[model samples]
Structures are given as structure tokens and as C-alpha cells.
Target: MRRKQAGIALITAVITAALVAALAAWIAWRQQLWFFQLENQLDQGQARAIAYSGVQLARFTLRDDARNNQVDHLGEPWNVPIPAIPVEQGKVGGRLLEQQGRFNLNNLISNGVASDNDIAACRRLFELAGVPPQRVDALVDWLDADGETRPGGAEDAAYLALPQPYRAANQPLTDLASLVRVQGFDAETIARLTPFVSVLPPQTPINVNFAPPEVIAAIVPELALAEAQAVVSRRAGRHFASVGEFIAALPERVRGQLRPEALTVQSRYFISEVDAQFGRVTVRYAALLERNGPDFPRLLWMRRR
Candidate 1:
């Protein structure tokens, strides 16, 4: 009887030891997972902070440029991209882009009406990009306040007819991504046009000093793409100091057709992008800034991801 009792006791002790070992392993695993999660959160916080600091750096540079320079161009110091610099745990980098360098889509409509000159310019731009110029008509209807749709346009009714119904936004676009909501604009089309076009406040003129060859050609009627390329190539040696200088440099044939009022040598709007990475976490910050006269650039909007 004593032997039987001893054997039963040993079996119970062995099972208890096995349970204790399994519990210890589970606790260790849980603690390790918790540490990993906490580290990732810390890395994310650090990366975001570094990204914001980079934005302030851009703002300071733009403010200095406003005070010192009369014109914004590719040759200016503010146009240069900041090389990646090592931070406490990782690196950060940034760049400034002149928004006025691209054709402004908001300029297509003014005072609740479509501007013929702007429409013509956009048509030329679309043709140059090999996109259907008819897309412009749809864009116009999207911007115009009235419900009447143009031949190639879609209004509220058309959108409501979709399988997933929505309404047309009869207003100026706040960002380039809004183009996907407009008729005839797909991801591919918007991507193709992004290099040459922008969505900025109304009446914003194209900054000739930084505009691409396609934009230069579009704005200057009768100017061929090759001639526009030559114009851009010349800017490498010396940027245009004034609209007059840009116009005078154009081919004599197209000079007569150029609208000096539709172009500028100065930029009022700019985009700043900064990236920061820490550990396995990365963050990107983007901001739109507006500078007027000798004042510091104003932050219009910002996003971090």
C-alpha cells in the first residue's frame, strides 16, 4: 500500500513540473512580443518627429529664398534636394518643388464660366500628352456650377447611374487625386498628366522659369515641342529673370502668339516632401506652402504617412 501511494505521488509531481515549464515558456514569449511591439511604436514616433523637423527646415529655406530672391527657378538653392543625413537612429531627406511649374487645372474656369484661353491651353496640353482632348470638356462640366453636362461631360445624374452611385463635385479640385472622381479620368490618365499639370488656386499663372518643356509648348501657341526643349535647355545656363526674357527667348514665329500675362518668372506656390526612417519604421511628410512678397511661406496644408 505504501509503494502504490509513492508511485501515485511521483506521477502527480511529474505532471505538475511539466505544467510549470510550459507556463514559463508562454510568459517568456508574451514578454518578448510585448517588447517588440513597444519598440516599433517608439520607432514610429521618432520617425514622425524627424519628418516634421524636415518640414520646418524646408519652411525656413523657403522664407530665406523669399527674402533674398526675386524669382524662383531650378538654379536657385531652394530648388536643390537635401541629401539624406544621419539622425539619432536613422536618416532624413527632403526636397522642394515649384508648383507653378505645371499648368494649373483650376485656371480652366473663372467666375462660374469657362475661360476660352485656359481651355485652349489645356487642350493643347492634352494633345501634347496624347490624351483625348475631349476629356477637357468633362473636366469643365465637373468644375462649372450648373448641372448641364457638356457633350463629353458627366454631371450628378451620370454619376448616380453608376453601380456604386455618387455625385459629381461641381467645384474646383482641392488636389490632383480628386481627378479620379471626374469623368474620363482614370488612374493611368491622371498619372500620365501629373508631370505637366497641377491643381492650384484659381488665376495661378505658369512660372516659366521652372515649367517643363511640355508646359512651355502648351502655353506658347505655335511653338513646337523641339523648340520648347531648346528653351528649357537654355535655362540650364541662365534662368529667365522676367516674363519678357522668357518670351523674347522663344522662336520668333511663336513669340507673337505668346500671352505674357499667362506666365510668370516667380512662383507663389511650392510643395515640400520629407522622408525619415528609424529602425523598421518610415514616415513621409508633405506640405503645400504659399509665399507672397517678402513674407515667410504659409502652410496651406500638410500630410504625414
Candidate 2:
């Protein structure tokens, strides 16, 4: 009887020991997982902080540029790309681009009315991109407040008839991605036009010093693509000091087609793109900055992507 009791006690003790060992192993695993998660969170926070600092640096650069020069151009310091620099355990880099370099979509309408000159410029851009120029009429209709659709344009009725019925925005585009929603603008057209077009505040003029060759050609009627390319290439060493200078460089015949009202040598809006990596985390930051006169640039909007 004593032997049987001794055997039972031994079995219980072994089972208890096994249970304890399993519990210890599980606790250790949980602790390791928790530590890993905590480390990732810390790294992510550091990366985000670093990105924010990069944007502040870009703002400072713009402010310094404003103090030193009245003209904004590709040759200026503000347009220089920030090379990747090592941080404590990671790296950061950024670049600033003037938004005025592209054709402003909001320029299509002003003061609750359609602007003829801006429409014509946009049409030219569309034709240059090989997309139907009539697409601009659809864009104008989308931006205009009235329900009456322009020729070859879409309105509430047209959209409502679709399988996934939705109404026209009837307002200025705040985000260029919204272009895909407008009638006659598919993904392919948006992709082609993205590089030359931008959504900025109403009536913002294109800065000729930084405008792409295609945009320059669009804004200047009768200017050949090769001529536009020549104009842009010449800016590599010297930038246009004023609208008058840009017009003077053009051929005398096409010079008359250029309108000074829709062009500028300086810019008011800029984009700051910053990338930061810390440990295993990476952060992408983008912001729209507005510089008013000589004052420091103000952050219009910011996003992390």
C-alpha cells in the first residue's frame, strides 16, 4: 500500500513540474512579443518626428530663399533636392517643388464664372497629352456651380444614369486624385496629365521659370513643342527674370499669343516631400506651403503616406 501511494505522489509531482515548465515557456514568449511590439512603436514615433523636422527645415530654406531673392526658379536653392543624410540610427531626405510650375486646374473657373483663356490653355494641354481636348469642357462643368452643363460635359443627370450613380462635384478640386471622378477623365488620362497639371487655389498663375515645357507650350499658343523644349533647356543656366523677359525670348510671331496675365516668374505655393527612416520604420511626409510676400512660409496642409 505504501509503494502504491509513493508511485501516485511521484506521478503528481512530475505532472505539476511539466505544467510549470510549459507556463514559464509561454510567459517568456509573451514577454518577447510585447518587447518587439514596443520597439516597433518607438521606432515609428522616432521616424515620424524626424520627418516633421525635415519639413521644418524645408520651410526654413524657403524663408531664407524669400529673404535673399525675389524670383523663384529651378536654379534657386529652394529647388535643390536634399540628399539623404545619416541620423543617429537612420537617414532622412527631402525636396521642395514649386506648385506654380504646373497648369492650375482651378484656373478653369474664377469668380463663379468660366474663364475663356484658362479653358483654352487647358484644352491645349489635353491635346498635347493626346487626350481629347473636349475633356476640358467636362472639367469646367464639374467645377462650375451651375447645373447647366457645357457642350460635351456631364452633369448630375449624366452621372446619375451610371451604374454607380453619383452627382457631379460642382466645386473646385481640392485634390488632383479627384480628377478620376470627372466625366471623360479615366485613369489613363489622369496618369498622362498628372505631371503637367495641378490643383491650386483659384486663379493661381503658372510660374514660367519653373513650368514644364508642355505647360509652357500650352500657355503660349502657336509655340511649337521643339521651341518650348528650347525655352526650358535655356533655363538650365539662366532663368527668366520677368514675364517680359520670357516673352522677349519667344519668336516675335508667337510672342503675341503669350499672355502675361496668366504667367509669373515667382511662385507662392510649394510642396515639401520628406522621407525618414529610423531603425525598421519609415515615414513619408508631404506638405503644401504658402509663402506670402516676404513672410515665412505657412503650412497649408500636411499628410503622411
lDDT of 1 by residue, 1-305 (tens): 99999999999999999999999999999999999999999999999889888888888888888788788888888778988999888999999988999999999999878899889989999989978999998898888875475333446677878889777677889889889988789999998899999988888999998889999988888889999999999998998999988988988878888777888888889888998999999888888888887787788888863
Tens digit of per-residue lDDT, candidate 2, span 1-305: 99999999999999999999999999999999999999999999999999989989988888888888889887776677888899999999999978899999999999879999999989989888888999998888899986475333446777888899887777889867789889888889999998899888899989988888899999998898889999888888899999998998887899877668888988989889999999999999888898887788899888875
lDDT value for model 1: 0.88
TM-score of decoy 1: 0.91
What are the TM-scores, per candidate, against the unseen true structure?
Answer: 0.91, 0.89
Model 1: residue 244 alpha-carbon error in angstroms: 0.6
Off by over 4 Å in 1: 1-13, 147-154
What is the number of backbone collisions in each predicted candidate, taken in the order shown? 0, 0
Give candidate 2 misplaced runs (Cα > 4 Å): 1-20, 149-154, 161-164
Reference-based lDDT, residue 218, model 2: 92
Query: What Cα-based lDDT does every candidate model obtain?
Result: 0.88, 0.88
